[model samples]
Target chain A: MSAASLPAGEPRAIPTAFAIAEALRIAMASDPDVILMGEDVAGGGLRPEGTEEIGGIMSVTRGLVGQFPDRVLDTPISEMGILGAAVGAAVTGLRPVIELMFIDFLGTCLDPLLNQASKFRYMFGGKARVPLTVRTVTGAGLQAAAQHSQSLYWMTAGIPGLKTVIPSNAADAKGLLLAAIRCDDPVVFCEPKGILFVASDVPEGDYEVPIGRAKVVRRGSDVSLVGMGATVGMALAAAADLERDGVSAEVLDLRSLAPLDEDAILETLGRTGRLVVVDEATPRCSIASDVAALCVDRGFDLLNAPVRRVTAAMCPVPFTRVLEEAYMPSPARIVEAARALL
Target chain B: MTRPPTTEVLQVAYRTMRTIRSFEEALVALVTQGRLGGFLHTYVGQEAIAAAVCAHLGEHDHVASTHRGHGHCIAKGVDVRGMMAELFGRRTGTCGGRGGSMHIADLGKGMLGANGIVGAGIPLATGAALTAKLKRTGGVAVAFFGDGASNQGAFHESLNMAANWSLPAVYVCENNGWGEFTPTAFVVPVKDIAERARAYAMHALIADGMDFFDVYAQAGEAIARARGGAGPSLLECKTYRFLGHYVGDPLVYRAKHEADDWIRHRDPLRLFEARVTREGLLTESNLRAIDVDVAALVADAVARAQDAPFPDAGELLHGVFATSDAEGAR
Candidate 1:
């Protein structure tokens, strides 16, 4: 319910992926119990010269193995084993931050998250504690295609025991990842692949953006533009373009999905009677649909117009850059959706 | 012919086997009387494997169990009363009535719940061992799975990872001849499941699953190897399940004669009793006293379980997440 305080350290420009890597480095240095494991997380598995390989697919865990070689392990290409073992390690008192490579790979290893980590504390009657953090890449802008380019945070967010969070920028990526790693429950940390290379001013040193709290990045009184992950950037872009049309738009970034900041959503809707949800995921049963339903359920009286959602079409992400861009919910679509509501 | 176990260890093994037998028998009766709900898989004929393997473990050691996990739970020194209450769906159960027969878990005892999914516990145990290795806890993790699970991808992946990482883990496969309704031989081309461990470059051992001494000796070596940081090993115990897959199944897959043959000739309890008494490691009177004690213990557990009240409706929403207020909001 409380918002994470902004970091007090001097700000420096860094990529979101580098910010995540720094956060992991801080967590490992802070706590001996914190360990990192995933496929090629450390890289350089069989290199004869033993040079550092790709720190991670996106280099989010780069240079971590050099400092904490024992803690940061390179796992085989087995998502099930990696996740299941992470759950086991978490229950046994070690905090494990595992990489799922991509959110779509969740299909291969759903049992550990759905049946094991998510259900352990409940199924064991409050006797178990799974302090496991699953960090995975999501979003559809890279033309990585169907399997790799998917914003499937809603799946984990919908589960009962799991905590799902997506950071919209570099600062939030570092802070929220720290929070997720330190939190006592299982958290699905979704990093937007679209923003992996995007650079922004981020604070150095340790700080945590509390999970389940949304940040009102830009405030206005006419229409509310709500989004998360990469879509939040699109929402902001749309809000800026809407200013030319004499429309004052408020931008709200939902940092956490599972704890769905109902109060924030309602407060934003109360201030602005019009609402538009932008999500990179498919329309059906997605966060866009979820927020739209939330507005209709709790903030219906506050709305002056019907809530609208601008989401990607319900189809596999095409490989062509142009088609992929078209498939993704763009700022134009968000502007159109917001205009429709107004 | 490993050295005979001490008299005290033999008595402990006998009590474990006896407790498992009495517990499963009580469950069968409870299910037959329609008192217990959900699927019930009994570990009647494979008592020796759990008892002997668990005897080598301590409170610091971890074990992940299969669906037919009653024997594993008892062998690991889980509170029989709590397990029985869990089966009865009472608030006082191990999982506070959340986990039934298939999912009973007591983490305080280092038993990482009985999993419902096939081959799910392998990676869990491997991970526990990884934790131990990372933390330098010197604790070894054991996974008790069936012959059917060995064919699952999880089994291979877990074994390969454990071997690659040299994790402190031991995988024990109870080759009970059948995988649910189907014969394991029909599905698995291999004659011995342990032979598959060669792919991972790990040592594979076999034991008489029906003999307490054999299983104890083999499990001891494997568990010791894991604890000593010799990496992972697979121990396959040739055994049988006397009961059908679940309580309600008619068991039409196997001929009645085949079931009768395994039940009569290869019963683990019978083999243990005969061997211990003949070897003078344990007297017949000693085993009979254990049997009586176990029977009384099981009866008391059932009585207490039946009397325990069910969890209130409010409990339905609790315990999902450890720290989030969202669980309470839900």
Candidate 2:
């Protein structure tokens, strides 16, 4: 893969959605194999004279249809059908970035994800590589209720063959998305809809935050706040609050969940024995529960207190504004959990 | 689109049908003798459909198959020894013993694996067709599913998607009378599965699956239409399976006379040999030679498979991910 086709360097402030779009543009610019397929990936209906284009519901893939007309295919609303086809397309020569619309829709098309895409490499004895990237919206805050709003990265992470990644900021969004697209394995990229417009400085061209690594967004010594996607922002906010009380809290962004950055988790846990896991997903067998187990199993002596987990209430995501807010794990909740652990 | 197949194509087609017959008979013997284990859905009566359809495809053309897929694999040129080894759970199998009988695949030959899940291969084949369309490879993909699969959502979804995208794909429903114990008529409301194509606005064809010449002629038009970028088409073959759903099944649902009639009257291999011999297209002696050669080939495959080893313990965790182990799972 040559890097010259990329839009040249320099960091700029852009929303997470635009950052992901930039990553896609760079991938398509550099490699002709990268193609986009999904429902309304381009808002303009498949009519000849429809002048308007919504790009996507969130416009994460805005302007890509015109840039690469042949590559940005607007598929019919058949989730299982299109996803299965995308898996086929990936095993063949092309790299397909398919939009599942929402992570909740995974239930409708679990066969392609769990049985086909994830098992092809293994079942075919490593002869075929399913280089498919599923970019779906996750997390709740936008009143997009029970069906559209749960963060289910843990489901994909549990599957042995799938790599799950979620970025907390604009820069990581661009880099990690590019990494997911270019990687040769089937990657389920959880793009938290709650932080779609969260803006920060992102590098302009081709870059990759490798899929399995973690980023220590903020360093502290008293208690380590581990988070993923939107929860990372909450962890940072909690770190600021904890610092006011003279208790330095380290914030770790678990960008990739499947290749669960075990070494990084242990390193951060070793440095700060007290750990608080902030997640928007339910606590039952979640990433939070896994990390807490990882700490106890591997870094038992390093602990100064029992591990803490601040997660969403174990119920359906509510549509009401106040109920949803209460359902979500806020920065105040993270601080409370971190303080309890300290 | 319906040009008659050449004599050479007929010879190859006959050999393919003979090979499938020999392979399935060998598996039946093995299963009966307690040598083979698990679900073994043999392609006993439906050889002509796979042979006729696959003859029109090139090496790069892809084929996605269902549980009853050994014939499709052989017609698509999968290595017989590898397929045999897979069923034997040997190391040198097509999937290194990982997929077993239900999941033999050779992508290099464009044979997508025999899927365990019903109706899954429809979209995979459609995806392969989409790849051919995008990459400009001049290739087409074929999905061979059962009468049962047409009821699943994948069948409808893939048909609509392939037609909408104008992809190069041929969906062949080997309507072998039964959908695993129950009559296809009991589950599928339509008399012919090809009628389902009208919903997607796709072209449809029906062929006598037991007659190789008829299936070949019909499949030729469908495949040619797809290759010429005329869009997707469905070809339903009215066929029957002479065996039970799986090797160990009691087959209590269907009367013995029903299977006896199909086996006696409509065996695809017998029909193929009789036609070729009757029209002077091929002699009985030539067809007999093929029968002889196929038996030897199948016997050799079985011998080699029996001698091969199962994969080592370490390999269990090796291929769970690309170039990596199922990490952290000891």
Candidate 3:
């Protein structure tokens, strides 16, 4: 069923991140196994009281602390500690959703994700399960600078044990977060910072979008524009502009990055001879490059033209708004890149 | 004044120490001979810490070990034959031989793998303790790290979390005076790592790691407190490693006298022998019989490991995914 045919959507105009936080809260409320641990979750520990909210700077986890007082936790500014606790809790019985805060902070706490949690089940001879989700904010937008803004889902996707998922919209964010929390594998749920405040029609009832699935947002025949996270919005906008120009653009929203939907990607590419990848991440050795490589490796003969890429320049996400805007993938850039391939 | 351990506990501790010593020496020889192919961090000097701490633990209690973890593995009841086979890169081993010296794991006995990365095990132990707490299993999780790991950010973070949550965990830092080649004096400026626990409001204890009784007494108290929901504790065991950082280091960086003296005069195995024999808890003859039995076990493991076949080419991709059929087969 299409969006127009569906019944009236929920009245609440919730931001994507808040919707995801609500889903986690609902899961925590329903299941005692669900717990949340992150930095400054119960704020004002070190500082004077009444300074900030329970959750950290995002305020996405605002009321979770009061709702699930024992389960909702504020950890030290230690990603490793948070991730490790999640791993242990998962192995025993608790399903923990840990916020990494920023994907850039992975440098400090990657071992728990990579070495420990990732390898636990396999190393334990298939005896253990780490049903853990690490929620981190990503993408270069809002001028958060290099350290805060990075779409590092591609990096996590490269790791074997992790299931890296990047939700492009509010519904996907809520559904994917719920699915990731319930999955028996370690999932890196990256929330694009730009999309957090973006409003969307999310259902009221509990729903989950299966992991390792891609959504075909727009149907077309000319060229396929594959994108993830914030770039998906860019691709859709670019598709609208492309449609006016008589170029029917098929927009593929790659909801999950790790167990990449090679079938959906190849099928889209097969039907549409031209392909363009729009990723907010850096150009060289990125998701853009990876998707292009996959197309060449599998659907090489199907392509009518060389795969085009609209990605950030190979540099750090600058602090200035102009530079950050230049660094992020824009709808204009996606349109320009897709037109070139066409 | 420390009380003498029972005959059974003394035998077990002595067995653990003796097995660790022999296993490290054997692994060292194997590495030199090119039988084992990975980096080998031996638990030679820090035997008492593993022996005594594990004396209070059973299969229910869990432990997360560092790279220097053969002693911990044996003490925690991992099959010696499986560990040896894994070191030899045979598929019959624990972890299906995928984990070599640094990654040897036995989850059945609650020995979480020996981690290659320093301070990585601290948080894992904290997590295991959390799992135990949630399960209400009354099982304590122990983290055996080094003085080097004590300085890592994870070490501090995990200690605070464990203390705050009242997780049943005991953080043991085997202060062997060195981390890899760098001595603790160069890496850490503090007089004692245990003193940092006061910041987290956790009880802290320091013990002579070379003395089995010292480690045993302190570990017993801390473990007891954890089970009783008192909170987490930091137990810093002043220990030493007889061998170099890896198997082949010249060890010229360390003051020769310090290591030499510890090995010769302050050997935990020798000290334990003296104490147990002096107290008449066990005779020298009884210890000799156990040593002989252990030697045979170690020899058999090595022999079997030598004869064991390496995993086939097709087996490389296996175990990466826990398939439904495979999970059911187990």
Candidate 4:
């Protein structure tokens, strides 16, 4: 609630991808336990003619392989192997950050993540501490199509033992990611492919925004707009566009999906009395649905209307630009959903 | 790369195999008599691998296990009573019975877990080895997986990473010839799972899994090489399961003769005892004395297990997150 009344600025420039890479580098430098591993992370292990880059799949980890040669590993194209190794390393003493490259590739390595790391401490009766972070690119906009573009945070967030965090902006991305790496739990940090190049002001130094907390980006007293990852940007845009129509919309950035900031959602709903959840994932059993259910269960009396959800339709994300556009939640859709609630 | 283990090590090897065989036999009886709850994955046929491999390991060395893991846990120095109590689902059990047969673990002994997930322990073992290398603990980690788990992604990734980094790890694929109900031939391609090690640039060795001496000799060299920073090795112990996949599994998928034949002739403990007695290195009286002591140990463990209570209901929420509740939920 105190997030409001803070200073506002012109939102300086810091690429979300760079912020992530820089934050990881800082964490790795500070803690020797932190290590990076992924495919093509070292950019084919070749530095041809002034190209001293790791050539990360998304370039989010472009400079790390050069910084920490032994620590920054370029693994084979095996998601299960990469994730499993990260789990192993985390349990043994080192905190490993493995790149899934793309979230869709999770089909190959979900067991180590879902069954093993998530249940280790619980199954072992809390004797284990799996301090591992799996970073993967998610969402559309790259024309990489369905295989590369998916908002699958709902699956990881639903699992009890894992903590899922997705940051919407550069600052939050750096802060939340640092926190995730430091936290003594397995976390799936999904970076939206759509927002990689998008920029915001990041505090150039190491800082960790605690996991399991929410940040209210835009404040208004009418309807609350809840969104995460790339959709958070769209929701904020929709909120800005809605202000001209005299519709007061409070934009809530649902950063940490699992450890849902129930207090923030309840407090905002208690004041706004209306809700609109926007997600890039399919409608059936998504983060949107989870948030809506949470509101109904806890903030039922505070609602002025049935919670509105603007999410990707229940179908495979199409490859075509027009179809993909229709498949994902748009800024206009967020505005319309919130306007309807108002 | 080096000479085989001496006669003294061989005798220790025989003792380990005999202990594992008797412990599993005792557990099988307990399960049939309703003394144990849940399912049991007996390491009945794979005694040589655990005995031979664990003999070379010390307190600093680590080992990760599979679901069929009671033998490794015991061989690695986990209290027999704690393991038995865990199998009985008692509060005083190793994991408070929260983790049954598939999840027995003793962190103090550096036994990560007997993972239910196939091939999952491979990467965890590599990771432990990485920690050892970085911390300069002068130790290595071993992952004992079944032939069925050899084809898994964790196996490949861990092997590649360990070889590339030259981490001190030994991935011993206990080729007991079956994974659950399916035979290894039905799942794996090659007759020797160790041959796959070449793909990752790791050294591979094949050993007689039914003979404790062979297992101990080969595994000892592999472990020494790894601890000396020569990198990971794949030791495929060719063995056969003396019992069904789990307790009470009817050997309907395979011929019952295979299990019968292995128990009668290829049994690791029997083979170990015969070799020791024939060599005149250890007497039958010494083995008989060990048998009596092991029987008492197992019986005492069972008695303590029956007396141990179930975990408190309120403690269910504890241990999921490492931090204090006020810090953050895991």
Candidate 5:
């Protein structure tokens, strides 16, 4: 959904970060079973009442503790413990929405995600239901350096039993977050750090953007730009640039990665014979590659030219502004890739 | 002062210990005969720790276990037949053959899987305790890990979180002095693993893993503290592993007499029987009768496991994820 530049004062309009907090509040209010935990989720631990909550490094969970004092928790700076405990809590009857601060930190606590939470239902003869939602920040562009800015959604999506979703806008952010909390399986809800400040209209109260469904945010015919999370915005910007050049570029926001909307990918390729996949992550084994491969394998007949991919450099996210800009996929890069496909 | 266990509790404890012992011993035959295929970390000597600690846990209380997990599964009320089928990798196994020996679980009985990763289960139980405390379920969570797991970062992180939150959890370290092939002493810096709890400011206790009465008593207080909302506890049971690590593992890691001494003098099952029979809480005939019943039960489980078929090729795709999504937040 292409959210217009609505006035911030407008009703129902909220930033992606505020939308996340709103979704958490709605979830906790409706289901007492739903709780949130992470490092600094409820900041100022062990303090008297009225202390300001940091709501994690990005402040997506800010003001949550004051709202849901008992449910919103501040965990130790331990990713493994946070995730493992969340897994245990989820299977045992609590819907936990945990913040991982940054997706780059997943490597420190992947065992709980890879071995325990993801595999529990399947491994336990379908007896265990891990209703867990891991909300973490992703993508580069903030100059957060390689350590904090890597797009690791590819790793979680590649896993057998994980549901990975990345919303392109604040509305989907609220909807997807709610759906994740309700899902019986473990969901990695990736929030692209680049778009956290972007304002969009979000529906008040509860609504779920179904998992595993992609949204065609901007539709056209000549070419399709495939992207998820932050890359979708770049694709939209690229589509705008392509439109000026009279190249009708369709933007397919691939919100869900694991149970990938293969139908949408093939359908987009059918309408627009040329395709360009834009990704913030590196190209090797990335979602961009996956989509490109999917098109060749399943939509080979639909292709007019070879599928083109615009992705970050294979090297780490550079610390310098100019180098990092070159490292990440930009609208210009996406437009250039789409031109090649056309 | 804590009172001794009742005759009924002792009988229940004996039955659980006997079931675990018989189950592992029966697997020894199956593994030796080449009926079971996967790595089998037998809970041969660590029976008392699982049996006694799990005796205090009910259906609502959760227990996360280590690779040597059958005993924890049994003590926590997982079906022996399903567990046997799991070892056999049959469709009827606890995991529907998706998980082999290292990952059998029954959430209905609060038996979280036998984790393949050494320190993985610590946070799970700690999280379960978080659920118990927040939901006011009056339930406690137990993590039964090896001495080796005490050194894992997950262990330290989980304990620190559990103590900070005052979660209703009991950390049961089955200190069999071996983490995989290496001795626990060679790896862990601390002598009593319970000393690790001090860093978290948690209550700590230790017990001779071979003595069921000692384990049961110490575990009782820990579980009580957890259930009473007083907070978490670390109960380190000084135990031994009869089997090397897995079935068919050569006994070359340590001297043969080390296994022999623990088996002869500190055997949990033998100790239970001797103590009960000597105290007249139970007679030899009564113990023998229980053993016969256990043997029959084990024999039936093995027969059923072997008779069960392997999962269908199509079954490979099942249970990977929730087939569909739920509406709204729950």
Candidate 6:
């Protein structure tokens, strides 16, 4: 369903970050077992008499501690500690939604997610469940520099047990986050920093988007433009430009990366006979290459031409605005790739 | 000094220590015979630390262990037969043959897992304690790590958070003198790992790791404080490992005399037996009877583990996720 057609109580316009915060609030309110923990999640722990809380560096967890003060905890600047504790808490019956602040910091605390949470169920012979949600900001264009702006969901998605999802807009942020928090398995909810302030209609209360399902945001019968997170908006923009040039482009927003929707990719490939995979992540071993491989391996006959991928350069995300702009994939790049396929 | 433990507690402590010693000794034999595969970090000389500290924990309390964690597992009341089967890579094992010695776990018994990565369990235990505190379960979580793991970033981070949040966590550093092949002193400049606790404003306590009574007394205080919402503490147990870091190691790092001296003079099992017999707390006959029973139990576990079936091929992809369509695809 389109954003305009969502039910009435849904806010007409809400920032994507606030939408995620709303999801956290809803999750904590729904289950007493749900808790939130991250650095600055509750702002300055020992604030001055009348000073307000900072919520978080991005304000995604703002106004949460006010409602669930005890559950929304402010953790020390320790990604490893925060993630490891979340895994421990999940095993011991608390559903903890932890924020890693930035995806790049995953290097500091990846053992908990990679070794512990990902292997718990399998290693324990199905006896254990780690219902943990690790929320982090990803993608370039915010001038967050190399350390903070890189998209590393591909690394987590490469893992077998962990479920990785990225929302294209505000509504999916709420639904997918709620789904992730309630899911029995460990999930990595990636929020694109570029789209954090992009306003869109978001449902008010509780809702869920299935973990492995993809949504075709736009329908067409020519080249299928595949994108996720911030790139979905870019793909749609490129599709609009292509439409003006008498070319129709179908845009698919891949919500989940680990349990990839192969059926959707092949189905769109079957209809369009051409593909352009757009990703904000680097070129090698990314979702774009994955989709390109999927088409080559399974839907080889369906492709009228070789699938094209519009992805970021292999270099690290640069700090300067000019270089950062050059680092990320643009709508023009996506349109160029789509036209090349056409 | 704390009051002496009751006769029953003392007897149970002796039994656990004896069982750990017997189990590790049996593993040494198994490794020699090439019956067991993979890395084996035996807890032969350091049995008293795990046995004594685990005595204070119940089923509701949780503990995260280290790579050398069989002693902690047995002391925490995990099924010896299942643990043995796990070591042998059998379907009936605790992890269904998925996790060997370094990864055995029983959530029902509150043993989170025996981690393979150094210092990884510290945050896990800290988190579990946070869960207990937030849920008001009155449960405490203990992280049993080695001296080498004390140098890890996770160790500092977990302790800082535990202290900051007043989480019901107990950080137990099983200072087995050696971290792998190297002496802890070579890597760690500080005389006492517990001294690091002062940075976090946490209570720091040291214990004779070879003495079960000392460990029990110190651990009891820390666990009690945590359970009572007094925040976390660090209990550094000065102990030593009898064998090499793993089964196949050449162990050329330390002098043979160093190992011989510890084994002869400071063996935890020997110390326990001497103290209990001298104090008239337990008779020689009683200790021997318990030892006999433990030997039989260990033998039976070995027999069962040998006879247990390997996991079916169909079971390969199971248990990766609680629910996923990708199961068995690989």
- B122, model 4: CA deviation in Å? 2.0
Please write out the lDDT profile of model 3 over residues B231-323, one tens digit for every residue: 899999998888889888888888888888989999998998898889888899989998998889989999999898887766544554332
Backbone Cα, N, C clashes tallied per candidate? 0, 0, 1, 1, 0, 0
lDDT of 1 by residue, B1-330 (tens): 244578888889989988998899988888888888888899999999999999889999999999999999999989999999999999999999999988998888999989999999999999899889988999999999999999888899899999998999999999999999999989998889999999999989999999888999999899889998899999999998898888878988889999899888888888888887787778899888888898999999999999999999966778777785445453
On DockQ, the stronger of 2 and 5 is 2
How accurate locally is residue B185 in candidate 1, as Cα lDDT from 0 to 100?
88
Give model 3's TM-score versus the native structure: 0.93
Residue pairs in clash, model 4: A43-A54
Expressed as tens digits, the lDDT of each residue in B65-127 for candidate 2 is 989989999999999999999999989999999888788889899988899999999999999
- Supply fnat for every model shown: 0.79, 0.74, 0.53, 0.64, 0.80, 0.85
Superposed model 6: Cα runs more than 4 Å off: A1-11, B325-330
What does TM-score give for chain A of every model?
A: 0.96, 0.96, 0.93, 0.94, 0.95, 0.96
Model 5 residue runs over 4 Å out of place are A1-11, A46-51, B325-330
Better of 4 and 5 by lDDT: 5
Q: What is model 2's native contact fraction?
A: 0.74
Give all TM-scores, in the order shown. 0.97, 0.97, 0.93, 0.94, 0.96, 0.97
lDDT of 2 by residue, A269-328 (tens): 999989999988998989999999999999899899999999999999999999999999
Cα lDDT of model 4 by residue, A101-184, tens digit: 888988888988887888888778678898999888899877788788888888998887888999998898889999999989
**Candidate 6 residues B42-143, lDDT tens each?**
888899998898888899999999999999999999999999999999999999999998899999999999999999999999989988998899899999
Clashing residue pairs, backbone N/CA/C < 3 A, model 5: none
lDDT of 4: 0.84
Task: Indicate the residue-level lDDT of A240 in model 5.
Answer: 95
Model 5's TM-score against the true structure: 0.96
